[model samples]
Every structure is written in C-alpha cells, then in structure tokens.
Target chain A: QKEVEQDPGPLSVPEGAIVSLNCTYSNSAFQYFMWYRQYSRKGPELLMYTYSSGNKEDGRFTAQVDKSSKYISLFIRDSQPSDSATYLCATGSNAGNNRKLIWGLGTSLAVNP
Target chain B: GAGVSQSPRYKVAKRGQDVALRCDPISGHVSLFWYQQALGQGPEFLTYFQNEAQLDKSGLPSDRFFAERPEGSVSTLKIQRTQQEDSAVYLCASSFRRGAPYNEQFFGPGTRLTVL
Candidate 1:
C-alpha cells in the first residue's frame, strides 16, 4: 500500500461554502501532521500543523488528525475564490534524518465566486 | 535573502543535459531539505542537511541526484544527465532547530525543472 493516500480532487464549491480535504496513512509512527496549500507556479505554503491527535485552528483553516483511524483533515470556513488551490497533506516521524516526509497526491480545489 | 530563496524559478533542459538548482535558506537556519514534486503530487523528501553536515540522502532516487550545502547556508541540487522522468519542481526548505518537533520547514519558491 502507498504510505499516504489522498484523492486528487478538482472539487468545486460555491464561494462562502465550507470545504473539507482529507488524507489517510498506513504508518503508525507519524507523530506530526501538516497541511499545505499550493498555487500553480508556486511552492507550497504551510497552512496548518498538528502534533499527536487533535485539532489546530489558524484563522480560516483548521487541521484535525485522528491517529486512531490514521486519517487527517483540513477544513476551510467561508471559502473564497482566493482559496482555490491544491491542498497537500504530509506527515513525518522525526526531524533532521527523520526528515522523511510521506505525501499524498494533492487535492485540487476550486471555490467559485 | 530575507525568506528562503530559489533561483531560475523555471528551467527547461534537454534530456541528458545536467542542471543545477540553487537555494538560499533563511540566514542562520540550522537545517536544510530538498524535495521533489511531480505534477498533482505532494512534495517528496529527497535529502536533508544539518548545517554543512549531510545527515541523510537516502531519499534521493538515484546516483544522478546529489545535493550539497557547502557553507551551511546556501544549497544546490544537481541532476547529472537529466532524464525526462527527472522533470519536476525541486523545492528547498529550511528550519530553525536542530532536532525533533521543531522541523517546521520554511520553503522557497521552488524551481520548476522540465527535461525535454
């Protein structure tokens, strides 16, 4: 099985709607979960990061991790056209040599105004 | 550079040609990383450096892929005899801490490499 799996979603939603993106993993050792947003022609910008299992909120974005189910999610409130981009999920067990990052295929999201 | 910086923003190379991508990390950052992102995929870890010491390079796909941080601040990833399969965006990232739990990697505007 792929270490991390995410549906590359070209998901479209009306502006102001709530959006949820998700990913699942097989590795039980991942202690850190992160969400990144990427625009075409740009590097991914870190949106939110969560350690262990819980929810971390940053303004319009919320990241939640369920270690029990090996699943993680990112929720966007009041989504906007500017929020249209690809969302990627990544996880790692350590830093430095532990810098190994398992990634899923990013989900493409379009918030139409 | 104030933020992590990458050069050439875009590069197109003929297959079998060599290519070098550069990155300037945030000043004094202790850790540097290289990642490869194929279309529609998340960035995959390629290698990492702690200051001038390379700690892990196992993520490199093959011998043609090499990265170095000579002065412990700036880094470069070189692809020798690049192949069409090597076409992807090469991203560089840096973090402030030396160890565990502080690995929040601040990224550069990656260099998109296309091998034709």
Candidate 2:
C-alpha cells in the first residue's frame, strides 16, 4: 500500500457550500500533518498545518488529524471560487535523520459561482 | 520581494539528452529542497540541502540525478542521459528555519520538463 492515499477528486461544489477533503496514511510515525493548495500550473502553497490529533481552525478553513486512525481532513466553510484548486495532504516524520515529507496524490476541487 | 524563482519554465528534450534546471531561493533562507511532481500526483521529495551541505539525498532516484547548492543560495538539478520517465515538473522550495519541525516552505512555480 502507498504510504499516503488521497482521492484524486475533481469535486465540484457551489459557492458558500461546505467542502470536505480527507486522506489516510499507513505510517504511524507521521507527526506533522499539513494541507496545501495548488492552482493550475502553480506550485503548492501551505494552507493549514497541525501537529496534534484534534481540529485546528483558521478563518474559514479547519484541519483535523486523527492519529489513532491515521486520518486527516481539511474542511472549507463557505467556500469561494478562489478556493477552486488542488488540495494536498503532506506528512512529515523524523525517521532516522531524514525529515522529508510524504505527500498524497491531492484532491482537485472546483467551487463555482 | 521574490519568493522563489526557477529558470526555464518549460523544457523539451530528446531522450539521452542532459538537462540542467536552476533554482534561486529566497535570500537568506537556510534550507532548500527539490521535488518531482508527476502529472496528477503530488510532489515527491528528491533531495534536501542545508546551506552548502547535503544532509540527505537518499530520495534521489539514481546516480544520474544530481543536485548542488554550491553557494547555498542557488541550486541546480542536473539530469544526465535523461529518459522518457524523467519527464516531470521539478519544484524548488526554501524555508527560513532548519530541523523541519514546522517551518513553512516557499515554492517556486516549477520547471516542467518533457522528454521525447
């Protein structure tokens, strides 16, 4: 199984709708969970970051991590057309001395007006 | 202020050709990273550099792939005898902090390489 698995979705939603994106991982050593947004032809930008097994809120976006289940989620409340982009989940662990991150395939989202 | 800049935004080369990609990181950033992003997939780590030192390069797919940050500010990823499978978007990122506990990385637009 892949270390990280995310549904490569082209999820379409209306503006102001609540959008939920999730990812699952098989590694237990992953301690930091992060969310990134990437526009077409642009590099990924960090959106939300969390290090615990609870929910973290930042304005209209919330990120949740469940270490017990090896699951992570990003929730967009009252989405906007600008939110139409690819969402990627990234995890990092201190395996030995390396600190590179493991990334998911990313979920493509489109919020229409 | 510039975030991160990568040269040769798009490149096309025939198989067995050698190509060099360049990255100019944000000034004074302590860490630099290289990642390969395949179509429809997220970026995968290729190598990491701390200043002029290469701490870890185990993620490099093969010996033909080499990266160097000689002055610790600009980096170059050189692929020798490139294969069709080497075609992908190469991304460069830089962070202000080290140790990688939770420093946010600033990424460049990336260089897309197509091998024929």
Candidate 3:
C-alpha cells in the first residue's frame, strides 16, 4: 500500500463554499501533519502544520489530525477564487531516518467566482 | 529575507546528456533537501544534507543521481546521463534547524527539467 493516499480532486466549488481536503496514511509513527498550497508554476507554500492530533486554526484555514484513524484534513472556510490551487497533505516522523515528509498526491481545487 | 531560489526555471536536455540543477537556499539554513515531482504528483524526497555533511541520500533513485551542498549553502543536483524518465521538476528546500519536528522546509521555485 502507498504510505500516504489522497484523492486527486479537480474539485470545483463556488465562492463562499466550504472546502475540505484530506489524506490518510498507513504509518502509525507519523507524528507531524502539514498542509501545503501550490499554485500553477510555483513551488508549494506551507499553509498549515500541526503536531500530533487535534486541530490547528489560522485565519480561514484549519488543519485536523486523527492519529487513531491515521487521517488528516485541511478545511477552508469561506473559500474564494484566490483559494483555487492544489492542496497537498504531508506527514513526518521523528523516528529512525524519517527526517523527510511523506507526501500525498495533491488535490486540485478550483473556486469559481 | 529572500526565499529559496533555483536557477534556469526551465531546462531541456537530450536523453543521455548530463544536467546540473542549482539551488540557493535561504541564508543560514542548516538543513537542505532535494525532491523530485513528476507531473500530477507530490514531490518525492531525493536527498538531504546537513551543512556540508550529507546525512541521507538513500532517496536517490539510482547511482546516476548525485547531490552536494558545498560550503554549507548553495547546493547542486546533477543527473548523469539523464533519461526520459528523469524528466520532472527538481525542487530544493531548506529548513532553519536540524531534525524532524523543525523540518519545516522552505521550498524554491523548482526547475522543470525535460529530457527529450
């Protein structure tokens, strides 16, 4: 099984709608979860990061992790046209040689005005 | 402060030719990383460096791939005898500190390499 899995969504949503992006992992050792936003032709920019489980909120974005279920999510409230981009979920562990993050195939989001 | 930057935002090379990609990391970041992102895929780890000391390069796909961060700042990834399968975006990232929890790597605008 792939270490991390995410839906490669070209999801289209209207403005002001709520957008949820998610990923699941098989590794139980993953202790850090993060979300990244990438626009066309640009490198990914870190949007949110969380350690362990629970929720971390910054402005209109919220990141949630459930270690028990091995699931992670990024919620975008009041989505705007500016929110149109690809969303990637990543996980990391401090164990062994896991200094690098395991990434999922990003989901493409298009928020129409 | 400036973000990480990469040179030759785009590169095209013939199969069997060698290509060198450059990365200028954010100043003073002790940890540097290289990743490969194919079309429609998330970036995959290729190598990691702590200053001039390379800590992990197991992520490199083959012996043809090599990387170095000389002087503990600027880095270069060289693909010898590039193949068509090597076509992908080569991304470079750097973090402020060492270890995992602090590995919030700041990425550069990757160099898109196309091997024809």
Candidate 4:
C-alpha cells in the first residue's frame, strides 16, 4: 500500500461553498503533515502545515490532523474561483532515513463563479 | 527575494539522449530537493542535498538519474540515456535550513521535460 492515500477528486463547487480535502497515511511514524496547492503547469506552493495532531488555522484555510487514525484534512471556507487548484497532502517522518515526504495523488478542485 | 529558479523551463529530448536540468536555489538556503511530477500525479521525491552533501538519494528511480550540488548553491540533475517514461516535470525546491522535512520548501516554476 502507498504510504499516503488521497482521492484524486475533480470536485467542483460553487463559489462561497466550503471545501474539504483529505488524506490518510499508513505510516504511524509520520509526525508532520502538509498541504500544497498546485496550479496547472506550475509548481506546488505550501498552503498549510501541521505537526502531530490537532488543528491549525490560517485565514480561510484550516488544517486538521488526527494521528490516531492517520488522517489529515484541509478545509477551505468561502471558496473562491481563485481557489481552484490541485490540493496535495504530504506526510513526513523525523526518524532516521525517512526525511523525505510521502505524497498522495492530489485532489483537483474547481470553484466556479 | 527571488524563489528557486530553474533553467530551460521546457525541454524535449529523444529517447536515449542525455539531458541536464539546472536549479538555482534560494540564496543561502542549505537544503535543496528534486522531485518529479507526472501528468495528473503529485510530485514524487527524487533526491535531496544539504549544502554540498547529498543526505538522501534513495528516492532516485534508477542509476541513470544523478544529481549534484558541487558548490552548495546551484544544483544539477542529469538524466543519462533518458527513456520515454522519463517525461515529466522536474521540480526544484529549497529551504532556509537543513533537515528539510521540518521546514517549508519554496519551489521553482519547474522544468517540463518531454522524452520522445
């Protein structure tokens, strides 16, 4: 099984709707979870980052992590057309030789105006 | 401040040919990383460098893939005898400090490679 699993969603929603993107990781050793936004033909940019469990909020975006279940999520409020992009989840471990991030298949989102 | 910059924004190579991609990381950043992203897929780790030292390269797909950071600033990824499967966007990222997993990596626009 892949270390990280995310649904490749071409999810479309109207503007002002709430959007939730999630991923599940198999490695319990993962201590850091991150969300990245990638536009077409562009490299990904860091959107949100969280360590261990709980939630971190940044403006309209909130990142939640549940270490017990190895599940992570990014919630976007009042989604806008500009928010249309692919959201990727990545997990990383601080242990030996495991510094590289394990990424999941990104979820594609399109917020129509 | 400029983010990471990669040269040859786009490249096309015939199968069996060699191609070299360059990355100019954020100045003074101690960590550099290379990732490959296929169409409709997320970026996959390729290799990482801390200064001039390559701390982890286990992610490299094969011997044909090689990356170097001789001066600790600019880095290069060389693919020898590229195959059709090598076609993908090569991304370069850098962070201000070492132990990259804990830091946020700023990425370049990336080099889109097409191996025919």
User: Could you tell me which 10 consecutive residues in candidate 2 chain A have the lowest summed lDDT?
Assistant: A92-101
TM-score of 2: 0.97
Looking at candidate 1, what is the lDDT of residue B97?
78
Report the CA-based lDDT of candidate 2 relative to the real structure: 0.93
- Tens digits of per-residue lDDT for model 3, B69-99: 8899999999999999999999999998676
Q: Report the lDDT tens digits of candidate 2 across residue range B6-116.
A: 999999999999999999999999889999999999999999998988888988999999999999999999999999999999999998777657757889999999999
True contacts kept of each: 0.68, 0.72, 0.64, 0.70
- 1 versus 4: better TM-score goes to: 4
lDDT of 3 at B10: 99
| Deviating ranges (above 4 Å) for candidate 1 | none
> What's the TM-score of candidate 2 when only chain A is evaluated?
0.97
Using DockQ, rank the candidates from best to worst: 2, 3, 1, 4
Query: DockQ for each candidate?
Result: 0.71, 0.76, 0.74, 0.70
Better of 2 and 3 by DockQ: 2
Candidate 3 chain B weakest lDDT stretch, 10 residues: B96-105
lDDT of 3: 0.92
Candidate 4 lDDT, A1-113, residue by residue in tens? 88999999899999999999999999888889999999988888999999868999999999999999889999999999999999999888778645577899999999999
Docking class of 3: medium
Candidate 4 regions off by >4 Å? B99-101
Report the interface RMSD that candidate 3 achieves against the true structure, in angstroms. 1.2
Those runs of model 3 whose alpha carbons end farther than 4 Å from true positions after fitting are none
**Which structure is stronger by TM-score: 1 or 2?**
2
Per residue, candidate 1 scores C-alpha lDDT tens digits across B12-63 of: 9999999999999999899999999988788888998999988999889999
Candidates 1 and 3 compared by TM-score, better number: 3
Q: What is the TM-score of each candidate against the true structure?
A: 0.96, 0.97, 0.98, 0.97
Among all windows of 10 consecutive residues in model 1 chain B, the one with the lowest summed lDDT is: B96-105
lDDT of 3 at B33: 91
